[model samples]
Target chain A: MSVLTLEDVNSYYGNSHILFDLDLEVEQNEVVALLGRNGAGKTTTLRTITGTVPRREGRIEFRGEDIADDSVDKISNRGVKLVPEERRIFPTLTVTENMQVARDMSSGNPRDIQEMYDVFPVLDELRENRGRNLSGGEQQMLSVARALIQDPDLLLLDEPTEGLAPVIVDDLYDVLSEVVAEDVTVVITEQNVDFALELSERAYIIEKGANAWGGTVDELNEREDLLDEYLSVGGAEAD
Target chain B: MVSLGLVFDQLITGLTIGARLFLIAVGLSLIFGVLDVLNFAHGVLYMIGAYAALWAIGAVSIPFIGLLGIGFWPGLVVAILAAGLVGVLIEAGFIRRVYDREPLDQLLLTFAFVLMLTDVVKTTFGSGSNVVDPPGLLAGSLTLTSSLSLPNYRAFVILMSIVVLAAIFVVLQTTNVGRLVRATSSDRDMAALLGVNVPRLYTVVFFVGAALAGLGGALAVPTQSITPALGNQVIINAFVIAVIGGLGSFAGAFVGAYLVGISIAVGSLIVAGAGQLIPFIAMIVVLLLKPEGLFGGAEA
Candidate 1:
């Protein structure tokens, strides 16, 4: 069974229709990437699953329960966390406070944020620093680490590596792999198709708000023609 | 040149006024910081508290202190509840619908409510001014200098303000609920996913903010006469304080309040006309330079 499922979800912003009957799912211990170009509703898909944007007509089920109408706070307390686009870390708060804020959300004991810091050793060095002071890569690491401390059942990350150095990309991949090993399910939306594929075991590609293709990482790797046609990356020979 | 005693008198008066501004401005900062709404009708909420206290004390028979205690205390509590209820009604009925609307539309709605509330008080209370005398225990004057005397009520207001700040500090810095409140203000949607009851929190925050305004009005009634427009003069000052302190910075509110308080006091002594506008001038400079108040970081 899927850990997180969105069935026929439709989301609207005022009169504008952004998400149209989109269906997606993430299974236990799986890293699934939602890939699309700008304005393709990738962010909205993540928001809808987490109940940030109102779903006009759809059902969102997480971990065997219907949670479409549940409050975002309620949905999150059930161990679902979202690291929003733009690395929405409280820039005013120190790394420790930001983590504490996330930890304080649920009623129980918080997950060990140290393990996250251990994975992103740079963040451990800058724990006393404000989130804004950190480089783009460090802020993204803080965002991911803060979410992990919640011991989330399903994690939603949007554009985790939109603007980062090449070296930071390797660090993010390491963290993503470690997260899945802890039995956490992840659904990440990414504009960087290469970066997403490096970390995600499964992939869903969309164009203009509709699901264009859905398959495993190996299938996407083999189908270079499909990637070149939709994502404009490269065909089979480009590698 | 004034003597040492004269300076002390002004210092005491400054503390009283500073504390009052702090209580009122802190709420304004919190409301604005979290939702980014200006709450133009905040003054009306204050007026409601003053009028509520007047009615409660007049209708119910009690001793002066009891009237002072139960009157302003209970009346302030009720006013806060009423203001919060009104806030929820406004939010659910109007603000909620305009959550995504342009800022101007929301401002216009709140401005309209301000006018409506002012009219409501004018019709109910008439144009007459009402004054609730301080309880005899808190009525006497403190003879700080041979000639200068300070009212006990003013001192009480100052003490209560400090107490209120201390309590809020405990909650915001140490408690779980306080942490949740801070987190939500930082990133609301993420806070929700972390299991914060945001709508309920919004309602609570609105009510608390309204209550603080109401409490300000109730406290003011003993020292000053109450009228429909009594809150109007104070609200702008409170806004200036909130802006100078940086909308959501709790400690910033105190800094802004005392800075403005001392400036206004000292300004009047130097140049009465310009002194009154010192806070505004300071605000102008602040916005021009920082735009975000002293303590506000990126959220500013």
Candidate 2:
């Protein structure tokens, strides 16, 4: 029941090798988190799976089909949506327009707009406001809402909680919990250890560009030395 | 007191020229904004449109159900369609390859297309300047003042351009397709993640942009000289307008067209040959003052 599997995947940026023999998997409706400090290849792993970062070697399978050579748009067509770290929202477009455009691009009957509004009422209140006018937290919400409207079978979120207020991060955690309840498989990369552990069922600690270790969230919580050496702190919100 | 009538005449002339410039420059701006491709062949697309209209009307005329051959209107339609189709083909065949290449590579690729397109037109139509009469409905002059008169065709061109502008605005602002276009133009990577087929969208945008340029060329038939170098003649000025307005900016193109057009018109009035230099000066001034161009701060 593995919805996505990246086996011994290697990725590069120009000549510099980024991800090295990275291995990961997400099961049906499973919530998995990739945790590491900056430059640990967590983001690159998510990108490789989404086909944004070209994998130099190994296999990436989604729904039991290899997708290592598939184009970014093609992978997206197979219901893989990525909310990147930068939260690249169209600043000139209104909030509603951003979500509507995503919904229009996806196949099948449109997801109910009311459901989106209900999930993020702040988005509804600022529906007519342009993307540039939104605060950082609001932009993050809009970015996440855009991906959600696509109704993807596999959601890839990279650093969704990066640079957000603790309160906003808590709100995002709540929204994502609701999303998980809807049975969409998610693979999120995070530097905030507590936040990642709070949402994900399992954790993979990435060291440099390869997988260092992975186990259940409870198992990760028990390994204080492993967390300290890779994630910079033994406990708490150490990135 | 001399008279305000001459000034009115010049204003009307300026508007006509601005409308034509807007047509060519808007497409250039759109292409740059979305695809990040500086299409040098856009001017040639305009030239192709002019030549296509001429050939459609005079050389190879299509027989209507009842009429013997096609007229100027049908020829104009053909010219637009031909230019748009050619744009799509070029985008798919040549420009698409350079999207991921260096900026210089893209410029060189498009510049090569320009040279090839120019030679093709020269070979097909000969290098000599030609003329095509305006449609009968627009074949006269309208007397706007006691001493001022406007060519009916120029008036028609201005009005038609306004309608096209309104349509473009409506499509980009108030429609779902426009939202997708805006989204794609804003961030292609993000749009792709949203499941937008960006390559196909790019092709459509290039087609629309080329078609607009072609329409401008067709409209110029009765007003401007038809020659192989016609594209070379107006393209620099069009680039200046796009730069002054801001590359990839709709409102920038709109305002830049008029700024350049009116400067040329009024400059001609003040000094003999200053009209030619005015647009460049305006471009330099805009660049020095606001490096992003007037409307280039963000894509619309």
Candidate 3:
């Protein structure tokens, strides 16, 4: 069964229609990437699933249960967790304390902290540092680690490599690859098409809140004209 | 010999007054931090507590010390529960809808509530300033001598406050629920996304915060008069302490209470009725330098 499914979803912010008949699904353990240019509602889709962006209409089913109107907490407790776009780490809390807050909330195993430290060794090195003190790459990693503490089944990552140095991006992607390999379903939204192309099993291109194109990663690579036409990336289709 | 004794006497006096401030300021601070609601009616809750304690004493028709286990303990428990219930009702009927609304709206609503509560209590209890003296067993002065002595009740109030503050500190520092309180206060929306039952936590915090305020008032009954305007004096004074400590900071509130309490106590010793001005002045200075608070960051 798919871990998450958005069936004929429609959402609006005030009078502005932001999402229109959005249909998507993520099978368990698959890495699906939503790639788009700015204002394409890439972030909104993730937020809607997370319930950070309010839902006006649609069925958001998780693990075969209908939880369309449930609050973010309930949805999260059911195992879908979102790592927000800006990496909303608690500025006032230390890295360890941030982990502790998540630990306090859920049935987190004590051993998970060690596993998280292993996932991001840099975080272990800076465990005592305040969230505000971490660099962008470090904060992104910490954000992921924070979500892991919740023991989520489906992890929604928003722009995990937005402003990292090349080496840091490499490190982050390596961590992402390792995580996705371990039976955790990941849906990453990125402006970095190359990473999405290489890492994701399936890809969707959205424009102004609706899916413009979707295909398997190999099929997506074959459609160079599709990329140029929909994603505005130069013709991988023609090439 | 007398002068040295009086200084010791004054130090003891400072602790009693500090307890009263602790009861008032921390209540306001907790509600302000978690609900982001200033609870203008806190003084009214205090007044209710004092009056309720008075009622417990009379209604039970028992000796005062006997009242501690019987009238006093039961009365205190009832007072906290009743006040906490009222806080929940107010939040449910009015506050929940206005969470995303402006603070000014909440301020006006709570202010109106203060007026309603004060008038209601005044009408029911009458405007008379009722006082409950220490029970005879606890009444006699503890000697610094033939001329000077301290009432055992006031000393008890001080000791009880230290115990209460210690308990509050332990709960906030160590408990899981307390951590949830801090999380919600720090970021309500973020807390919700993280799977915290935010609305439920909101109601619970409001109840507990109100209960503390009410308990403070009830505990103060033996020492002060129970009048309609009692909440007014309590709120104004607590606001100063809350500001001095940094709004919503539990630790800051605790220290602020003692500091402001000491300031007022010392002020009254020399300046008489004008000592209250010290808190106002201290509040203004703290506001100027540390707007976020003494320990916390800028208010969200």
Give Cα-based local distance difference scores for all models: 0.77, 0.86, 0.78
Q: Compose the digit string of candidate 3's lDDT tens values, residues A1-239.
A: 89999988888777788988888899998999998777788888988887877545889888988878988888777777788888888776778877777777664343377788988999999988987889998999988888887777888999888888999999988988888888789899887788777779998888778988887999989988877776767535321
**Tens digit per residue, CA lDDT, model 2, B71-153:** 68997898899999999999988899889999899988888878998988887677888776788988889986678888888
What DockQ was computed for model 3?
0.52
Instruction: Between candidates 1 and 3, name the one with more favorable TM-score.
Output: 3
Q: What is residue B231's positional error in candidate 2, in angstroms?
A: 1.0
**Which candidate number would show the highest DockQ if scored against the true structure?**
2
For candidate 3, list the clashing residue pairs, or say none.
A224-A236, A224-A237, A225-A237, B43-B231, B67-B72
lDDT, candidate 3, at B169:
71
> What is the C-alpha local distance difference test score of candidate 3?
0.78
Candidate 2 local lDDT, A1-239, one digit each (tens): 89998898899988889988888988999999998888898888888888887446798999999998988889998999999999998898999888889888886455877789999998999989999999889999989888888888998899999899999999999998888888799999988778878888998999989989989999988988888888887455443
- Give the best candidate by lDDT: 2
Question: Could you tell me which residue pairs clash in candidate 2?
Answer: none
The worst-scoring run of ten residues by lDDT in candidate 3 chain A lies at: A230-239
lDDT of 3 at B11: 60
- Candidate 1 per-residue C-alpha lDDT over A1-239 given as tens digits, one digit per residue, 9 for 90 to 100: 88988788888876778887788878888999898777888998887777787655687898889988877777788888888888888776788888888777745557776776777788889988987698889899988888888877788889988888988988788878777777778888876788788778999887777788899999999998777777777534322
